[model samples]
Target: MADVTQLIHDYLRHNKKFPHVFCAGCGHGIVLGSLIRSVHALGLPKDDVVLVAGIGCSGRMAVYVDFNTVHTTHGRALTFATGIKMANPRLKVICVMGDGDAMSIGGNHLIHAARRNIGVTALILNNQIYGMTGGQCSSATPQGDISMTTPFGSLEKAFDIVDMCKAAGASYVARGTSFHAIQLDRLISSAIMHPGFSVVEVFSPCPTQYGRKNKFRNAVDMYKWLKSNTVKVETLKDPTQKPDDGRIPIGVFRDVEEPGLEERYFELQRKLMGQNR
Candidate 1:
């Protein structure tokens, strides 16, 4: 029985199978660190952890992790992860996806997954642009943002990921950024420890794509902006108050327990079997 902190270190040192494909200041690294730490804290067996990822930069996490990772089709990580968790019921399913992968091509799956309230954790790396797909705007990208598809500026509004998940019945929802490493880890660990569906939207940076277009010099500059522009909800409790022009909200926006899909389904099954008994 190693100490929790020691266990985290051990896992990081010993789990050497995952390949690294993330950019230099990619938030995926921070998210992964937090996730691995959470798993360590939970003392979940590596073999019992199933990480499903979609086709994107963040999706590459599946290949780098030591768990039973599945690199599924584009925007299908949640669908596959749902199946895996429902079938096994014992495995801890964690879905890792990029904003475009989760909120666009996989939007239907994401909505239903949240509505189902499956006992799983979904980590969304929201870099605002489709990093792997040549820097196109994603559903999570802010309005007026510029991408390859929207050279001048984007016309469509962005989806508030936390609100969307909350509306769809996610038990726990949180938003964090690459700059808030410790807080991000805490939120992620809390999500994994939760018994119902949890989503941690991580604000990542696409330096090469988004940065260049947005006039950010590099990943570090982006990180600095993230740290300064992030607003914790508690700090903005005034009724008339709102985030600044360029600021974004970040924190454990919502967390509440609910009857997870598996639990409810099993209860119904038990009742059906009881009639025969």
Candidate 2:
């Protein structure tokens, strides 16, 4: 209900630590802006919000925001976030991770968390490489792409995070790029408000890593690629089918109702306690 832009401005302007560590033209800033706006829209108490970030460039986000923030080791943010949400269902737990963190070493945890329908919103900043680790090829790295680990070109296929989340039983799954500002903000808000596991895969650009290696001059050029390549959901279904032209689909792919993990845990606890009495 609040003006999303204003809310983002207020949060970033007042928070001295934020927008500083975030690299100029970094998608982390965009996603953080959208996330702050989403939290403002939810009208949740500041004390009740918990932000968990995994190790990476994106992980630095936790250090900036004013909240119950945790910056954990690589690929473990979701696990910690899930535990926090389960222990205190009243808190709003959000897991922020990079592409490599969520899709590589964290893949198993990512899927399992979705399978359990943990009441935690997971946001992946998919920049397609291990940016902080010097541009190693990550699971989300596009096929035939070049990185520090793949000097010639990567032979492995890239993981479609949205599809993977949907298959893993996430209650809500969406994909948005940094270019789609309004849609990203809305999707993030929806993911946060969802009752069960929710994933918002944000296709961002890693200018310092992926972009430079691939010949883009800077981050703005990478943004142009994101803008030009992203396709609308209404224009087509089955986003897995890649067009020869290279357009990528970006929108809410799937949403279904499911019992959240914390609620089920409490229900079982209640029954067990009754039996003990």
Candidate 3:
């Protein structure tokens, strides 16, 4: 196998930004690494790819990657990515968002983007809690979980991002964890290759905040918990067979061909122009 460090360096933006800002034991770095590997595996030109990120730990990912990047405001990465893809459909656009950034504040934008079936890939790093702005409860925070804002435990139910995307009309939807680095890479690569709106919800661990407050002991404990609590989609061949243990279902939940918004828009424009002449 190739040196993993060298492979990561191939897609990173070296310089003063050499070091990242993620806390120790944070799984965002692992997700970032998988993203880089996915881009590399596709052999996409750095100049042809555009990475847009929102405010949060996952938002900082665009700044570290060697690509045409845009750091947008919180909960607006998808909006910007949508405009980018619509304006120039040839460019590969990817949006990086945290659980709160994507599902809470930007939830409307996310669903609309999926509903439109735009040619943009959304990568949501779901660490359960809002790690960047302290350990606050987010939309994806599991019920009964403790957080800075949820001292009495979170009461709201968690959002199943994968199901939401699939229901919202995303052409491709997949879920993976930081522990499954290789599978995460493959999922991301597949998302990028998909023509319409695609979503990859990565279950990253927030060791410092979420872990410390939730009695996770350490990052390893969190990883083990993730592995044990998630069941591969292939294992549950029968649609009626649900995981009796309440484990989150992981793997590609949806992948199908669809006419993307960009393509349809351009085709309509071409027809209008021809008719006018």
Q: Estimate each model's TM-score.
A: 0.91, 0.93, 0.97
lDDT of 1 by residue, 121-215 (tens): 99999999998878898888788999999998999999888889988989899999878877887888888877889999999888877888888
The numbered model that scores best in lDDT is 3
Residue lDDT tens for model 2, 1-277: 4575666665553546433675667788888888887788788877888999999998988777777899998999998998899889999899999989998989999999999999999999999999887899999989999999999999999998988998999999999998898899899999988889999999888888889999889999999988888888767755556555778888888778787899899999999999999
Clashing pairs in 2: none
Q: State the C-alpha lDDT per candidate.
A: 0.85, 0.87, 0.92
Query: For candidate 2, what is the lDDT?
Result: 0.87
Better of 1 and 2 by TM-score: 2
Model 2, which residues run further than 4 Å from truth? 1-6, 12-19, 237-244, 275-277
User: Which 10 residues in a row give candidate 2 its minimum summed lDDT?
Assistant: 10-19
